[model samples]
Target: MASPIHQRLREDVLASVFAPDEPLTEAKLTERYGASRTPVREALQRLEQDGLVERRGKAVVVRTHSAEEIIDIYESRIILEQAAAAKAAVKATALDRQLLTGLLTQMQQLDPSDGRSLAETNRAFHAQLWRATHSPSLIGLLERLDQQVRRYTLTTLTYPGRWPVVLADYAELLAAIGDGDSARAGEVAARHMSDALDIRLKMYAEDPRTL
Candidate 1:
C-alpha cells in the first residue's frame, strides 16, 4: 500500500505550504498526518535523502536554497535543458512528436483559471521533452534539476500576464524541436529557461518570502 502520510507531506513541501527552514519535529508531522512516529520518521528521512529537508540540531527543517544557489540551479537547468532539446531534435521519434502534440493540445485546452492543473500539465510537458532526449544520464540530471526547480515554483498563471508569456514560450520551443533544428532548439530552450527564471525572480522580488 502507498504511504499516504509520506505522500501528503511530500505534497505540502512541493506546494510550498511548508516554508523553508521551518522546523519539522516527528511529533508535529505525526500529528499533522494523523500517523504514528515510525511512518513520520520514515517520511522525513526520505525527504532528507531527496534534499528537500535536512536533519538539524534536534529536528528536521525544510531545506532552503540561497538566492545564489537558486541562480546556480537555473544556470545548470538552462545548460541541461538546452542540450536536451538539441539532442531531442535529433532523436525524437514520430510517437514522441505525437505525444508532445497531445500535451500541447492539453495545455491549450486547459482552463485558464486552474493553476494547479496548469502546473501539473507544465511539468508533464517538460518531462516529456527530457524523455525525448533518449539519454538516461541527461534525463536523470534533468529530473534532479526539475525537482529542485519545483521547490521554488510559484504559480505562473496566477501572476498577472504570466500565463500568456508561458504559453508562448512553450509553443515556440515545441515548434523549434518539431522542425529538427538543433541550433534553433537550443536557442529556444535557452530562451524558455531564461524566461522561466525571470518569472520566478519577478515574483520573488514582489514577495521575498515566496522563495
Candidate 2:
C-alpha cells in the first residue's frame, strides 16, 4: 500500500486540487499536507514516477500535456480500454454487473447541469469497469493512464450534448457485457474513446483552459 502522504498527494494531484504546471515545492507541500520534509520529498518523488509531476528547470511542478500528447494518450487508451472491456465481458462477475448497474442508474438520474457530479460518477463507472477485468496488470496500467488524463480538470461529459451520448455508449457496453459478447464490448469501448477524443478537441478549440 502507498504511504498516507503519497496517496493523499496523488489524490490531490489527480483531482486538480493542484493545477497543472503549478510549482510543487517541498516546503509548501509539507506545510499544506502537514508532513515532515523527508516524507514530503519522498511523496514528490513517487508522484514524479507516476507521471503526475516533473522537474521543470529548477522546480518540480504538476505535469502538463500538449494537444499532440493528449491525442496520443487517448489513442493509447482506446486500445487498452478496448482490451479491458473485452476482458470484462468474459470475466465480470454478477457482483461486478450489479455495481455497474447501480452506477449507471445513478448517472441516468443525475441532472445534466451537474458537471462535477457527472464527472465523478463517470470516473467511478470507468474504474469499476477496469476492476471488472480482474487483471491486476491491466488494471494498474489503465489506472495510471487514467490518472494522467484526470490531471486535466475539464471532463468531456460536460461538453454540450455529450452526457446523454455517454449514457447511450455505456448502455450498449453494459448490454454487450451482459451477453458476454466480447467483440461487441470491445467495439463499443473503442468507439466511446474515439468520441471522447473528438469532444476533447472541440473543447480545447473553444477554450484552451480545457487542456
Candidate 3:
C-alpha cells in the first residue's frame, strides 16, 4: 500500500505538472516535494497508471495533451457540463445557489493576473457546479475530467487577457443557474466549455509539441 507520504507526493506531481514546459523527474520531485526517492518513484508509478504522468527514457514526464485528446476531452466536457448544468438548474436547492453565489463573489475579488490562485478558485467553482447535480456518478465522472481540463486551462491562463473573459462567462453561467432556467443554464454551460476548448485547440495548433 502507498503511504501517506507517497499520496502527498502524487498530488504535488499533479499540481506541478500543470505546465507542460516543465519536465518531471524523480530528482526534481524529490527536492520539490521534500520526499525520498522511494516515495517519489511510487508516486510517479501511480500517476502513470492514472494517465497523468508518463515515462520518457529514464525520466518521468508529465503527460502532454495531443490534439486528438484535447478534442475528445472537450467533447466529453461539453456533454457532461451541459447535463450537469441543466440538472443543477432544476434541482439545486436554495443553499446550493447561495454556495455557488459565494464562490462567484470570491472569484470576482481575485486578481486576474494571479494564475495559480485563479486556477484554484476556478476549479472550486466547477466542482461545486458539478455537485449541484446531486448525482454521485456524474460528479465522479466530472472529477476525472476535471484533471484533464485543468492541464488545458493552465495553458489558456498563460495567454494574456483571457481571465476576464473567463470570469464573464462564469458570471453568465451563474445567472442562468440562479434563475433556475435549465435550458439556458445548459446552453450557457455548453457554450462556456466550447469556448475554452476552442482556445485550447488554437493553442495546440500554434504549437503542437508544447501541448
Candidate 4:
C-alpha cells in the first residue's frame, strides 16, 4: 500500500506531467519533485496504473492521446459534463456560483502561452461544478475520465487560437448555470465538448502522429 506521502507525490507527478512540454524521466522527476528514486518509482507506477503515464523501456513518460482515444474521451465527457452542468444548475449554492465566477474571471486573465495553467484551471472549474451534484459515484467516474484524457485535455489547450473559444463557451455555460437554466446549461456544456472534439479531430487530420 502506498503511504499518504506517496499518494501526494503521485498526484504531484501527474500534475507535472499535465504541465510538461516534453517527456519526463526519473532523474528529472527526482530533481523537480525532490524525491528519492524509490518513492518516485512508486509514485510513477501508481500514475501508470491510473493511465496518466506510460513506460518506454527504462524511461517513463507522460502519456499522449491518440485520435481514437481523444474521440472516445470527449464522447464520455460530453455525457458526464452535460449531466453535471444540468445538476449544477439545479443544485449549485450561492457559494458554488461565486467560486465558479471567480474561476471564470481567472481563466479570462490567463496568459495564452501558459497552457498548463489554463488546463488546470479548466479542470478545477469543471470538477467544482461536478461536485455540486453531490454524487460520489458520479464524481468518481468523472475523476477517472479526467485522468484518462489528461493528455488530450492538456494538448488541446496548447493548440493555437483555442483558448478564446474555450473561454467563450465557458462564459455561456456559466451564464446558463447562473440563471438556473438547466436545459440551456446542459446544452452549452455538451456543445462545448463537441467543439473541442471537432478541434481535436482537425488536429489529428493535420498530423495523426503528432497528436
Best by TM-score: 2
Instruction: Give lDDT tens digits, candidate 4, residues 53-128.
Output: 7877767776766677778888998999899889889888889888988998999998888878988898998888
Best by lDDT: 2
Give the range of the ten consecutive residues with the poorest summed lDDT in model 1.
149-158
Worst 10 residues of 2 by lDDT: 151-160
> All candidates' TM-scores?
0.86, 0.94, 0.79, 0.75
Pairs clashing in candidate 4? Answer: none
lDDT tens digits by residue: candidate 2, 16-110:
78766688889999999898999999999998998889999988988889999999999999999999999999999999999999999999999
Off by over 4 Å in 1: 1-4, 17-21, 31-39
Error of model 1, residue 20, in angstroms: 3.5
Cα RMSD (angstroms) for every candidate in the order listed: 2.4, 1.5, 3.6, 4.3
Question: Candidate 3 — which pairs collide?
Answer: none
Model 3, position 73: C-alpha lDDT score? 84
Candidate 4 regions with alpha-carbon error over 4 angstroms: 1-5, 8-49, 53-65
Decoy 4 TM-score against native: 0.75
User: In candidate 3, what are the lDDT values of residues 60-159, reduced to their tens digit?
Assistant: 7777776888789889989999999999998888888888889888988988777788888888888899889998998988888777545557667546
* lDDT of model number 1: 0.83
